[model samples]
Target: MSQDSLDDAYANATYIPGAAEYPPRWTKEARAFRDNLRENDQIIEDFPYGEGAREVFDLMMPETPAMGLAVFVHGGYWLRFDKSVWSHLAAGLLARGWAVAMPSYDLCPSVRIRDITRQITLAVTEAAAHVAGPILLAGHSAGGHLVARMACENVLPTNIANRLKHVMPISPLSDLRPLMQTAMNDDFNMDEAAAMAESPIFKKPLSVPVTVWVGEDERPAFLDQAMWLAEAWECGHVVEQGKHHFDVIDGLTDPDSLLTQMLIGGDIA
Candidate 1:
């Protein structure tokens, strides 16, 4: 489909209602996950990004110099949640002797989406300097948007973009035009121009590897976004998880899961 036609279809698309309340049950599970992080894990909270802006990121390091680092960005549709909620994701990477970094960016409406993307760039660039080895990027939801943006060489410093061995955007929001038509945009404050600018599918593909994964049970829009990114980048792999949006991330914590094997570079069946 033409970009314009896609935009038009997205503009007219119906907005699917998300969970009405914060998934309290998931939040509780996340808390337990956080408590279980290795004792040696280090959290560098509220690191400065730009003037008057800070991002929180936690680091989980193994006993030896890591073979590679995995940086994870948390998802909340660019408007809600924080890094504390995703420390659980670090546990599995740490066990594999991969250092992990989870960064929290300022949410939208209060801060424009572009600025939020910039903040993530800053966080990752800074985190990269401190780690000992190559870096791999991963994120869930809005975080997937940010990390995908980093794959674009022009969007990030040349050094940082080139340093990425791979990028895994889980349950990503690859196209933002659909969001402009939804109530979610009320806080996102995105117009046509902003949507096009932030949409990864509209950007030129990076040479770096990008793997896009989405839950089989997710909304069609979500699944389409993943497919769009995979085709646009032409360097991404799409994995279908027999799970829903929220539960799909749980795969990150299970080393035996396909998601983990892909992230850590295990043989894919």
Candidate 2:
């Protein structure tokens, strides 16, 4: 495909005018909620998994005894965002008594995408150490790709992998090769080999089942991505109607949302 066509396919943010404004809102809400939690001593803030400035995590302890561990990884296309902006997204999981941990990894351009996979693997393992029982991974966009990568990267041991109940990658980029043609690739510096190495689509079959979700109104490529990964991994998928790329992930912050329910392994009935 021509470079223009390819870039258009990946231009998710462009589809949503004023998408730039979302981050500020996330920052404001996340900071306020985190402060409330801190005032009540309800959170473990800036807990480190690595030495880098971005390698820390924020743990939001559920009010009740935690049933399982749930890690929410943020999405900035492997380049932006930190755990702090996503603290508020823990509400749904927290309400279910699931201990929620959000980890920040070194961004691309600073570190290759492969390095991010390692950092996230370390973060998840570290978070899991502090909580007991099976763990569920729910990530958005790039975060979705990361959680999916964690599932098949040979990073988790059978013991830990066995305890994994679900792997959900919401609006994830399962195939990274196409990204090489997009402007996002400018910061990402993805060559053919690196894309092959990083795309979850090329990874071995997962250690656990994966559930994919994408906004029904998202770009065609995104919908294809969800279906492609599901087919590649032999998993299932849901096209969230009336949702776009950014808002599609709003479900993670709502405990009653289907996305949250999927992670908790419970049914609406």
Candidate 3:
């Protein structure tokens, strides 16, 4: 592929038809889901981790005694989507007796990716403070990359860090340097140095196990990133056949999914 083609390859919109529709639908569905949760007083809304407007998160408490927290970070290539669009995705985790915390963060153009990474560290840390048990960290897309970084680097303080039981980065862009050649870089403004610093593939092996799951039908770049990171970190990779970038995240919302089972400490095979 030419440089331009390689750059286009990184943009999911280029490969997934009707990609623009997902966000709006996600917004609508997630809003309704949150509203329903709030109506029954099943959720804790607007719990702030930072002063910024987007630094807040919604905590969906499990109906029974809680299992643990599944801290999920929303992804928009570090540009779009807030935590609002992802509230319902926590249903699977919630059903499995896990309290789910979905956090929002400042997006790009207003903040750098590094800043977003830090915000998630703060978000996860804040969520940990409230739920003082094992933390199952999971994120999708760019959010996936952030959680992976948290695994490699010591994002949380020692006390909280030890509570992080597992990390799941679904279809993560673990190698961020490639984005420098893509149009998304316009908003990201990720120079070579920053990309290298942020890419978890370049970081040290994580002490916590990271189970990476990807869609078989996703672009090769996405596939390569997951496989590369799993190999580099000596972790597990679960490739679901016939899934694309968009539907690949469906696992997060399904209790019986291999991906969700991985996060909740169940069987994947």
Candidate 4:
């Protein structure tokens, strides 16, 4: 595809079709997923946070001491979804001898995107305090964007940022400029200044390790976002596999997959 076509696809892939048509059903499925995951795991429900918003994180540990901590952030384009839906992800990391922490932040429109970012930062920082060893940050979609931001902040001497081992941004939205063209902007509220400020691609390279992952079948925009962030950071790897946006995350569940190996600090071919 041409460069322009690729750009258009990334900007529009996050746009949900018929979003106004199924609020009830959507809520039912989301809740079901959350409840199902919670039933199987020992999760720390409703971890407190700023204002009225709070985050819930599920911690999964291996039988022995953990090799490290993997803090995961869920993505609903920064609007929907929560940590509960992603608790199943902990099983894979747990088997690999790594502790996993999944945290949910307040969705957009209720809270601005900036505040949402801050809330996630607080959630990860708090979780890091209780877990042993350094952290490997990972997230899907908007969650990927948040992880990238946290990795960039590792340049600072803050306790949380300093403890970061690496970052894996799966199908991340690195550049917010194109998102302004979509209806998602309604909740994202990406003013030109905020877009530039929040975008990881526009920021300086992070000293920490970063690995970008996108499915081969994902929209061009999604792939570009991964590449853009990888280039901007000037210190990461990118993997394009034969999966789509959602299925790409499923690949991480497989211990032998490249996604899992990268998370565990193994060689990625």
Structural similarity to truth (TM-score) of each candidate: 0.86, 0.96, 0.95, 0.83
Which lDDT tens digits does candidate 4 get at residues 1-269? 45455445754334445434444453455466446556766345665544554565656666678888898888878878776566656656777778777787888788777777777787787777778788898898999998888877543337767777878998898998887766667777778999888888987655677888777877877878888887777766566656777657765566666678887787755
In terms of lDDT, which candidate is stronger, 1 or 3?
Answer: 3
Q: Which candidate wins on TM-score?
A: 2
What's model 1's lDDT at 32?
Answer: 75
Superposed on all Cα atoms, model 4 deviates from the true structure by an RMSD in Å of 4.5
- The TM-score of candidate 1 is 0.86
Off by over 4 Å in 4: 1-42, 49-53, 154-157, 267-269
TM-score of candidate 3 to 2 decimals = 0.95
Q: Per-residue lDDT for 1-269 in model 2, tens only?
A: 98899889877879987798888888888899899888978899889999998898998888889999999988988988888787888888998889999998999788899999899998998999899988999899999999998899577756677789999999999999989988878889999999999888898855677889899999999998888899888887989899998888787778898888887889973
Question: Which candidate model has the greater TM-score, 1 or 3?
Answer: 3
Output the lDDT of residue 117, model 1.
87
Backbone clashes in model 3, listed as residue pairs: none
lDDT (tens digit, per residue) of candidate 1 on 75-97 = 88887888777766676677677
Report each candidate's C-alpha RMSD, comma-separated, in the order given: 4.2, 1.3, 1.5, 4.5
Q: What local lDDT does model 4 show for residue 138?
A: 89
Off by over 4 Å in 3: none
User: In model 4, which residue pairs have backbone atoms overlapping below 3 Å?
Assistant: 10-221
Off by over 4 Å in 2: none
- What C-alpha lDDT do the candidate models reach, one value each? 0.76, 0.87, 0.86, 0.73
| Shift of residue 200 alpha carbon in model 4, Å | 0.5
